[model samples]
Target: MTASPPDNSAQMASPSYRLAVFDQDFLLSDSLRGVRFLLEFAKADLALKAWGVRSTVVVFGSARVRENGDPDHARWYAAAREFAALASQRGGAFLEGGPVRDNVIATGGGPGIMEAANRGAADVGAPSVGFNITLPHEQEPNAYSTPELTFRFHYFAMRKMHLAMRANALVVFPGGFGTLDELFEILTLRQTSKSPEIPVVLFDEGYWRGIINFDEMARRGMIAQKDLDLFGFAETADGVWQELVRRGLKPHEDLESLTKSP
Candidate 1:
């Protein structure tokens, strides 16, 4: 065989040639997409675990719900805030300062109910988690979340995984598509036995019943009637906490009284 032409691989190489793993160009390539996905999962996992977040009470709701300015907005926002504070105080989040704790409030990390819940945790001097997603519009980490515990993810799947993987309970406020998607995702996981039993409390029975006709679906033979027991309805923050406790949630010893402090 003719001698190969003078090799120019070194000359042709770019910054990607040395320390390829650290090269942004190489890392952003299609071939590395899977690696990127794993990095997303691993980054959040390590950070949360390191922070001693053993379990979370995930709050899902509409980013449109406001703390004021409208009737529905006021109702949902207040309920979410109260619920988050209750969960942090009673759900083992502050029971001990160690490598494992339960019921740290976790949110989608955007405005509206997410902000309200995160703000509620902060109100009680508790650290809360925010799994913010990189969205094209209207999605950013609210200021209330603990800075170190707040995480941003480019993939919804990874974000959802982090949301569900450590959830001890789920409190859903009235929301649109995104909220429904997350609620059903967890429900499906529980229904299929992919995840352990997660107490799901849907706030505002009227709102949810209007949006989703669970009874109708069951009557029509779409979903099993027993599926109705998968979740419960509540109108107030205290009701949500009570329902969770009835479903076998154990509160921290310090939470002997379930009264909401004024």
Candidate 2:
């Protein structure tokens, strides 16, 4: 693939800047592109190691939610803290249950609940990884990300690949468009048979219900009942771990031959 610019969020802001100069069957060399990609990959790899994680639970959320926000009785921060801890426990369970301990924490590497999750993981002595995007606003990688684990990417696809490649499970916290983007991508992967059948746990039951009405969709027969079975929801950290253990989550790599391949 040819090189592309960072944060291509805008169209042709610079006339001199060409996106990809493909020359026939041979793509022209973009020195900076290769360097940056390698640097990012290396950084991510290092961050993964720094935490001594054997596996990870990819957590998704907004970078804007305050530790004090509320539309209901519970604060988002409380929920996020549970998300981080629950994923870790579930990750640990997968490890002891004949699965490798890729049991580290992973995130979009941004703010909001993502930061909370990562922070909680760190508090419990597990390392966390952040696959940050090269977005225009509110997309910066959170400070809680391990120094080496932080990545700013030109390609959301690549960032996602990093998230999916080692993920044993996914815990989605409340978020906006970006969170929805990652959330749906994983769902589509499972629906289209592109991703492993790993457990997808959505945090905050009420908030989720307020945002999207999956049950109503099922009622309308827009999605089959089996399709609706693709994910689960949880309230407390312990309950999240219980669901994962009950369903039997394993590393994506171990389940590869039996799952949908990219």
Candidate 3:
């Protein structure tokens, strides 16, 4: 019997034909990075829209914070949890089966203060969002976040965008670089008016003051004196809620009550 000829036609077929949207190998390829970016944004956006998350109260803080143990850790963790519950209860998160959920708590979706914030919303029977990122150390989403609303992203940029896009306010806790990075990203956006004005509250005035000398920045002309007004400090969870309200975050429930008032 003669040997069969080589299947050159099959070998010459375009690789694109074998490519599938769900194929990790193809999706992670350099040529498909842009497509992956779009997919990341679209998927999160679609899920958020379907869930009726009109606006969010973003919480940023140290993932190392603990609910119990060290006094400082316990304090920060407790405050984050309380703030989340307060935001949910008073920031329009507990709507009457509506499609326009507002001020829903959003977190980094890891442990520490992120977990506390999500837990707080859960305590109030409110749906919260978790924008988790894939990290080298295998960071996992906290159980307190709404399972259906939890999202995992490989791109930090996409995660940040989702966190910032619908934010009605940002409450930051004592943290290191990651926290600072996120805080400044929004601050820069607010400074330039690239995004709408949203109140930024940094919890624990002492911690923030020690880490950053805002007044010195103003004195050195690194930032305008008015820039110092961009964010306020809150020592307690109730204080944080009050500051947010003072900065003009009207709850959906309040809107109805205000309308009914003679």
Point to the candidate with the largest TM-score.
3
Q: For each candidate, what TM-score against the reference?
A: 0.90, 0.72, 0.91
TM-score of 2: 0.72
lDDT of 2 by residue, 163-228 (tens): 987777888877889889988888888888887787888877787889999989888998777888
lDDT, each prediction: 0.88, 0.71, 0.92
Candidate 3 stretches with Cα past 4 Å from truth are 1-16, 254-262
- Quote the positional error of residue 213 for candidate 1 in Å: 0.7
Tens-digit lDDT track for model 1 on 1-262? 8987998888668675668777888899899999999999999898888888878899999998889849989988988999899888888777475446678999999999999999999999999999999888857799999999999999999999999998888999999999999999998998888998879999999999998999999999988898899999899999999998887666654233433444
Task: Flag the better candidate by TM-score, 2 or 3.
Answer: 3
lDDT of 2 at 182: 87
Poorest lDDT segment (10 consecutive residues) of candidate 1: 253-262
Model 3: per-residue Cα lDDT at residue 135 = 94
Q: What does candidate 3 score on TM?
A: 0.91
Root-mean-square deviation of each candidate, in angstroms? Answer: 5.9, 10.5, 3.4
Residue 75 of model 2 has an lDDT of: 60
Once fitted onto the true fold, the runs of candidate 2 whose alpha carbons sit more than 4 angstroms away are: 1-54, 71-74, 93-100, 250-262
Error of 3 at 89 (Å): 0.9
In model 2, the worst 10-residue window by lDDT is 20-29
- Compared with the true structure, what per-residue lDDT tens digits does model 3 show for residues 60-145? 99999999859999999999999999889888886677657889999999999999999999999999999999999999999999
